[model samples]
Target: MTLVTDPTAPRIAIVGATGAVGNTLIELIEQRGLRYRDIQLVASARSAGTELSVDGVAYPVHAVEEFDFAGVDLAFFSAGTEASEQWVPRATAAGAVVIDNTIAFRMDPDTPLVVPQVNAHLLDARPRSGVIANPNCSTIPLVRLLDGVERRYGVRQAVVSTYQAASGLGHPGVEELREASRATLDHPEEVYPGKEFSPSLAFNVIPKIDRFLDSGFTLEEQKMLQESRKILGLPHLDVTTTCVRVPVVNGHSEAVWIETQGVVDRAELVELLAALPEVTVHDRRSPHEFPTPATIDDPYRVHVGRVRVNPNNPRAFWLWLVADNLTIGAALNAVQIAEELIARGTL
Candidate 1:
């Protein structure tokens, strides 16, 4: 697909427009003051005939099977893996560059898995297969910081534990959390019963995010290790992860520990991390302040804090990280890739 060099006018379509990530994409478009000649909203049959208003302008949502993709220069897809597998080729064939937010093509060998700030250069290949993938939400914020570290001191091993928000499952996940919360309030001592999340997600944390594999790691956990390596170009990096589903409604947080190749100092590390434009360092010793998922206000930046150098291993360090799973981790990254394509005249 070819995009007009004119920044003011590029035809764009957002698939799964009524979904949480789709809504977040619309919000970011308005917030970033982006201009487009046309913006189309496409979704499933049930969402057809519905209207979604962005920046005071309402765009009618159409079913994907019925929507024409010919004029679309760029398409942002947040639909499930099944839908992506079916429609992405059609969209690309219709001359639309697809930025898919599903696991469908992430490890496709040909399709580039991109987090714009971390690996925007990968998009330079323009998906010889005609599709680019947005990495898993949990992997997005993690890799952004790791990129900086890998560029400087060379990371050798890492461990990550995630506290994923209810919103990770989309609108249904958020609603389920709300229902569970209400039920828990009614019966203070009773465990809330819900199938959407195994065990109750209210007043409790689920140690598992996705289904467990034969290797004992959940799919969500495996994605973190695999996607991190691909994004950082470290095919054999030692990485392990434990993904948990927390009751929070908005942001996803993680605790990360890393061992670099060389000795490092806390002060120097913080200075280097702070210099990354997409990362916000909230570390401070005196006031006992740090970043938490709930305390983050801006949805675009990843918040990092609690920088600690391992006393036993000076080459190792630990930190806390947080980001909006729907925005920066999903929609914003897709949009940024589109913008990067435009900047590099690849769209």
Candidate 2:
């Protein structure tokens, strides 16, 4: 493959180059063979000067302060919300279209919040804000399925309980969980000194993710409700969530209970879910055939299983979903958005 860009390729930049999502972005770009005129790896000051390889070519990671965005056509910002708030405008001002993976701009009226699979049509033109917001990780997988269901059967409400992984907090959260797990197994009484997770996450689950808002729902939970409404184009959609942080090192799962406007058939429901793009529903004859975070075969696709209609209420049903938080929830979705923009000649 040619390392130099062709005339049509865009020059791209990856912010937060040292984070989990950033790493996954680079991997996906290579895996999908995204054409780029040039690629820049950018991170905070501390991570600068380190070199990372994209497609076997080592490029020095640049400090955000030093990275120039003047000619960059597309930028993917996986940095924290604060970083996006601070640096995204600079990138946009310098003529880069930003695909941000943060809560900062998802609800911005000028910036369209997008999950390409669910709402790629929003990318028909560049937004007024010069940025495209990637939805919350938990919201992306949920909306992808809900979009099709809403179109087919009409969804009235959705109740979701997410089993999130430590990786959602990035590399530090994963490191802390593993270290804490080791410490707990060796010394059952002493607590591991943790700055990433409170009360420790060793063999324990935390029902809260992000800060608690005034409505008794955590910020992460609130993101799901609001982001889903935006992505699905349902202003009055009902979605209540309980976001939990589990001990799993990667992959996030959700147990979803949905109530539709009309009766849903079990066999038809399985076929409908299976027909959706990049979705796998494991509903064979075996009782144990269900998608779990640990058992998912494809990290890039949303894995669904345990499809069953409510016995008493024909309008309700339950299902299980597993997605790679780093991939489907963050990097893959961002990459797919870029693909859509490129296809539309908007990038």
Candidate 3:
């Protein structure tokens, strides 16, 4: 966060600097040691006068309207879809490359929807569009493993059910769940009248996330399907998901059923998955070996367990995975994309 005079390193800006993902992005930048000439912290006008520190040096939050993007060589956006739609173009037009964590431009023909683990080759050159889209929280971890399976075993179909955390909605959702849970515990007969999510997320689970589309799938579910195809470069890939909002607080977990084109040996499959970069696999039968959201030791890595190939169908298998939605699913991915861009001199 210190102002450096290195001309080769990009001068960076973080839009949505006050939000949860924005905070996580800041943490990762310090942890990963991404080189930057200087940094700008931007947020809504309401948060403008506040200050946030990066690398222990405090930086004042600038209102998006007042911040100039001209000198910012790299800009990271996590300020929801509407904000990205409104401000991203202005940032890009000012010669800043955007690493966007929104649905705004993921499907744009010009913007590349990226999950660096699977298709980082797309970042070898500057994108034709001034922006790069980060995949959905759940889509990211799923595609990371699916890419490995598809290359070695040839994935014919992948059916996943995501048990997403409250943090997927960011801080407000987490606060609502906590207050509602406390309220429920205090008075079991009273309804909390929570506003963050429909029904309630206290001691309960919702099968739907985002708005329900005409196709009957919620927008969250649809993003998983469409984003996977685009990120994996599989136009017609058969990947289906049921996105559920669980009572947990931060990590996202998925139960995947993948049917491959050929038979797969369980041992080979476990070896294959563990070989993936930054992936941890628990193939042991011991009950304590599997990973849970609270049990994940490394927030930066993808955790997979219960790797069982169907005995009746050797070509089909079941696996469970847990990942920090904030890190692997959002902030870390964006930072990794920036790292790749910097290393490749694409920024």
State every prediction's TM-score relative to the real structure: 0.95, 0.98, 0.98
Q: CA lDDT, every prediction?
A: 0.87, 0.92, 0.93
lDDT against true structure, model 3: 0.93
> What lDDT tens digits, residue by residue, belong to model 1 across residues 1-347?
12225655678899999999999888888877656778899999999999998778778999998889998988999978889999999999998889999988888888899988887888775788788899999999888888888888899988999999999999989999999999999988887778788787987899998789999999988888888888888899888999999999989999999999989888889988888877888874432568888788677899888888999999999999999999878998888888888777687
How many clashes in each candidate? 1, 0, 0
Question: After superposition, which runs of candidate 2 have C-alpha atoms over 4 Å from their true positions?
Answer: 284-287
**Ten contiguous residues with the weakest lDDT in model 2:** 1-10
- How well is each residue in 1-347 modelled by candidate 3, as lDDT tens digits? 43568899999999999999999999999988888989999999999989998999989999998889999999999999999999999999999999999999999999999888899999988888899999999999999999999999998999999999999999999999999999999999998897987889999999999999998989999999999999989999998889999999999999999999999999889889999999999774442478999999999999999888899999999999999999999999999999999888898
Error of 1 at 160 (Å): 0.6
TM-score of 3: 0.98
Give the winner by TM-score: 1 or 3.
3
For model 2 the local lDDT of residue 81 reads 98
Name the candidate, 2 or 3, with the larger lDDT value: 3
